[model samples]
Target chain A: MILRLGADFLVAVLFSLWAGRPGWPGFVIGLAIGFVIVSTSDLAFGRPNHGRRLLWMIHFAGYFLAILIRANLQIAREILTPGFNQTPRIVRYPVQDLDDLQVTVLANCITLTPGTLVVDASEDGRWLYVHCMYAEDRAKAVNGLQKLDDRLRREVFSW
Target chain B: MDTVRDVITVILLGSGLSFMLIGAWGVVRLPDAYHRLHASSKCSTLGLFGMLAGAVVYIGTVDALIKAALTLLFTVVATPVGSHILAKAAHSRGLRQWDHTLSDELADDQRDGPPQV
Candidate 1:
């Protein structure tokens, strides 16, 4: 639980830097607000087993940052190259092994991926409708997405 | 020289801000969250990016240049994220569209295909 609090605090500090939030005062306030948010989640969900959750959160953040870097590189290449890849299609791909927040996280991860955008999801959350700029292998891509979803959504978030 | 840079910066900043302001208006005035997201996500980001770029041009330091590049990169990443989550939430909450949304392709798959598990 203390680890979770510290991890959440780190997240808050990173968020402040990312947001360009003014100064030390702003950073402190940001952490406070983040603390409230984390505490509430703990209260509501009764907190995940302490050590495992910390490990997961660290792993999750690292994985996310790495993926973000990769995605940006692809986008940059696509923009610069201008006519290399084609296979744009919007399709609804089925998903399993997740809940709402995980699904949400999955969908956003898709959106962040350069070649794809998550257009919508099914009413029952059975499928995520994705429009891929280069939709070569939906199965392969979705599998990659599932790996990410499992690591980030399942382990880190305690979802 | 300074005047020229200032004018260019002003134009760039104005263009970006206009995109953002207009997009924000679209968000408020547009009929639905989906379309509004279309406006806000697409336009506002480009706007913000443009504004940031303009500011970067004005500052023209190595640090500022790196920061601007990072900003552009991350905004591209984050905006779509936010939009996707909102769209998913809307879909889950039964927010129907104004028009027939072409066809429910995912729904079709469930009935026709074998069980996926």
Candidate 2:
């Protein structure tokens, strides 16, 4: 506990210097609370590979936004057009990054997109159960997500 | 000496407040959850860091400064993870997304590799 505080304080100092703001009281208070909260959670849950996990997570997050924004724009267009045919169907899209966390992320991205909903997700790392909305080209809709995986692999994971 | 510190402190406080406000705005204005996370996480951390810097300067101690700095770093490190988890959980829960998702990562996973993380 002593060590934890010490370590937290040390980290707080470093971060403050880097951020370059002034005022001691709020900084100290907030830092202490943050440290305690994070440590408690870390202790309760086994320490994950913070370095690699964080790396992957950050990249995942970055791409996730790009994909999400694009998806929203596409949907708006579909909605405004009277001829828009919202033919939603369940399809199997193959998934990788065998980590359960990664798979879950992918599944959710699919469901979130407009005109589509993930009907079922049970492929045993072989394929993902995906539903598409107005897929003019089945291959195209499935192909779009590949860039996210590539970005994640290149930026976050080596393989 | 005191005057210098006071000026620095005020500046820090002002900047910190701005960041917090910006983050709040982002939370509301951003198009979707993912965008909101980007603005809030990135901006909130920046704001927190700014506030901490002010604290360090006011205290005028290397120890205090170091502690403040650590807070910034840890927050930077931790926030993305939290955001990632939230995003993933949101996605799985079937939140609606933009339609123009180009270069589907999952499709690539199907052909040559795995899915998006």
TM of chain B, each: 0.85, 0.80
- Give the runs in model 1 whose Cα sits over 4 Å from its true position: A1-52, A157-159, B1-78, B85-117
- Model 2: per-residue Cα lDDT at residue A102: 64
Measured by lDDT, the strongest candidate is 1
Task: Report the C-alpha displacement of residue A36, candidate 1, in angstroms.
Answer: 16
DockQ-based class of model 1:
incorrect
DockQ by candidate, in order: 0.15, 0.05
- Badly placed stretches (over 4 Å) of model 2 are A1-159, B99-117
Q: What are the candidates' interface root-mean-square deviations?
A: 8.0, 10.6
**Which pairs clash in model 1?**
none
